[model samples]
Target: MDNAGSNQDKGNGKYAGKFPKIAQQTRLLNILVIFAVIYTLYLAKSLLVPLFFSAFVALLLSPLVAFARKLFIPRTLSAGALIVLLVAPFTFLGIELAEPAERWMQSLPKIAAEISKEIEEISSNIDAYATPPAEPVEKERSFFSWFGDDEKSPELSPPQDNTNSVTDKIKQSGIDIGLTLFGNAPFLLAQVLACIVLIFFLLVFGPNLFNVFVRDFPIVTNKRRTLVLVDQIQRELSSYIVTISIINSCLGLATAGVFYYLGIDDALLWGALVALMNFVPYLGGVASCVVLLVVGLVQFGLTSSAFLPAGLFLVLNIIESQLITPAVLGRSMQLNPLIIIIWIAITGWLWGVVGVLLAVPILMCFKIILENLGVFDHWIRLLESK
Candidate 1:
């Protein structure tokens, strides 16, 4: 009877020790699940990106929807208004871009000719400045010899340059670009579908989606706190998108005006490019300036005045960036510029243009959520505590 009692006590002790081990295993399993989920997302990124875009747009439209609802507008009408307001402008821009882009494409051959001419001029200028290596003059004093020239009937010395010719370089560049654009079409189609679907769902059920998240988390028992966090996330996302669009639009209009003032034929095209680039933060400004410079160089000859259009673009950007944008987004996008640039580049790599544009809103949403969480809240402090 004593030995049996001892065995029973030992069994109870062993069972108690197993709980911590079981808990550890469970924790490991959870971590693995998280990693697998992330991997799965990466693999399905094609499907995810467009849906993500729609989700963001839907969030962006929520405040407008809410305001309309408050004004006694029906939900369907409000949704339609938001969709039209959002989608119509893009469609119009697409149409507008088509003509300019086509013209630009048509102008490529002329541009190529101009480039070649400029290159030849540059080579001539360089040669003019350089002392030519003196070739030994073979004095051939035949009756048919040049009146004062000692130049031999130059047997075409086997073509002096083995380096890729300029034409080859141009053709290679075009082919490489064509191949890349071709490769991405499938992903692009997926993204478009995802955005439309996500946006539709968001407009129809954005409110319910938030509620479901709050109410249905398996272990996150704090429903109200989660709801508040989710609400803040939506607000921040919407604020970013709306603010970015308005600022970019204003910048675009101003840029177009500057180009018009400069007598550029495609002012609207340049402006649209500037506006689109502005969505990309730091990198966009430099890229727009470079493109404008090239356009200037192409439209005008390589004379002293060839850079004026580019200069105009620079001036406009300086005014818009240093004066206007700062005042508008000063308090809002207080995230670190360097970090934002990095995130944009990474997302842009994974998902391309839309990803780059969406990076800011996504970051804002993340910062908002992290602010509400416990340890991850430091990102908020570092990003937004300004």
Candidate 2:
């Protein structure tokens, strides 16, 4: 009986030792899977970007599509109509703004010269009061003097004038860009058409697909939970996107008004630019500010009022971010600023501008799923603003 007991104890100890090894292997497998997924996303971005864009747009327009259905409109017709209505204003705006954008492009050489001049003037003004550091005197018997002093010092070449070279390069770049864009126009247009078609089909058939998916779940509770999770995600995300769109539109209008009052000729363009960039949160605002500062410097020189445009924009942005957005989004949807920045950085690195725009929405979806699953409470806390 004692030998049997010892044998049993030995078996338990052997299994216990293997258990930790097995668990470690599982962890390593999970880590490898995560890395593989990230690599796949990076590699397949060209394909995935359009798909993601279609999905998000479909999600956004889902409510409008539902409304049109209630009016007895065919899903196909309604989807097409909604897409046109959505795209028409932007198409018009782009047509109107093209001339201004071209004008800016044409004036780049002048802008560059003026900016350089301003920088030089500032440096000269600072140099007037600033003491220059004294040059260090070389020792007569320095180490390695024997090796170097025998060799004639190579003659230093005079700096060549690069101004014309820079201008030429810029013109060449513009021409090359124009050529490339013209050449790729068909491909780009096809991609755009494909994405629209995808969105339309998704709108028309998404419900059926989702219902099928939910119905296929093995357990009743899983089916119910899946339905609830999807519904909440769609509802909340749609509402959030719609609200943000309205707010951004109003902010753009307000910015245009302010710029017009400040005597900017292209107030509408600047406003439109701001509104578009505002989609990316913290990084977007900073970029807008930098662009505004450069615009101010170019238009108004280094005067005190030169700072007004950017400064005023900054104030408006602060009010929008700190007061208006918080009040609108509320605590429930609030996310940690750090997580947002990190996620944006990661996505931006992976997929450029489109990824940056999609990062927050994707993160919100992740949070929503976690909430529904009722697991990873610690992760929920980490992601939450509070």
Candidate 3:
């Protein structure tokens, strides 16, 4: 009897131990399933990128189709006309900007040389103001020096003398310029194709498709609310794009005027660049300023003169951020600066400029979806009240 009791007790202990092992296995299985799903998504990531962009473009261009239909044109015909209209304007702008941009690129070397000299003068002026940096430094190497020749890739190292290695310069510049132009090319090409394909389909058949997609959605009292949410998102994003375009164009014009007055070469190019780039958030403005400063230095052979363009930028940036945007855009759709910066960095890191460009809209889409699902309503309410 005692032996039987002992065996029973041992069996119970073993079973309890097995239960924990089973739970652990279950947890691991769940984790693996999640990872598997992520991996699958990663594989299909290529397809998703283009389709996502196409959907966004479709959303933006939807109103035009609706307007065309209102004018008594067939919806399909309206969409086709709108697409051609968009393409023509887009191409025309590119062609107009090309020659000036080429001229600016060719003159970059001279501007860089100018900036190096002005930096030294600025240091002296700072000393005169009694606000000198703790470290006495002079002759900050111009940005152009960082890009080494093709024979050797520039090695990135902090130059003791404050001049970055030419190799380091090349690498960093490539990241800033090349990836956006080239890395995104494949995705952009795919996106363009998808847009062309979908635009016609949507124009001819969007009504049916939208109806089908919505048919199986949860039949709840909130269907109307859900639709309103979608309409609100579409309007907000479209308005945002239009507003941003206007603001950027103004900034570009202002940049051109300022630089031309300062006798900067290729001022028109710089202005156009500024206007176009400012469409992006923090990075856009900062990059244009950097490029402008560089161009000024190369052109004027001094960084002090770079200030004329820089000053214009500062004034315009402030106007846009404080007066223009706020007065126009208001606060309802405003995003948190902290989140914006972080997401920009993350998206830029993961997928480069294309990622950064899409980040805000992507987040906004997610926010709207969450709101529709009631997942973010509480948070949004808190945000609004505060």
Question: Judged by lDDT, which candidate is best?
Answer: 2
Instruction: Determine which window of 10 residues in candidate 3 has minimal summed lDDT.
Output: 151-160
What is the lDDT of every predicted structure here? 0.76, 0.83, 0.69
lDDT for 159 in candidate 1 is 33
**Predicted candidate 2 versus true structure: per-residue lDDT over 57-167, tens digit per residue:** 999998888898999998989998999998899889989898987787666666766665655666657765684544454445657777774755445445434243544
- The sequence of per-residue lDDT tens digits that candidate 1 reaches over residues 128-187 is 588455455444477766475655564433434423268556655555655666587686
| RMSD to the hidden true structure, all candidates | 7.2, 6.4, 12.3
Question: Model 3, range 186-228, lDDT digits (tens) per residue?
Answer: 8676677676887667666875666555656565446667567
Residue pairs clashing in model 1 are none
Clashing residue pairs in all predictions, respectively, total 0, 0, 14
Q: Between 1 and 3, whose lDDT is larger?
A: 1
Q: What are the models' TM-scores? A: 0.77, 0.83, 0.68
- Summed over model 2, clashes come to 0
Which rank order by TM-score, best down to worst? 2, 1, 3
Better of 2 and 3 by TM-score: 2
TM-score of 2: 0.83
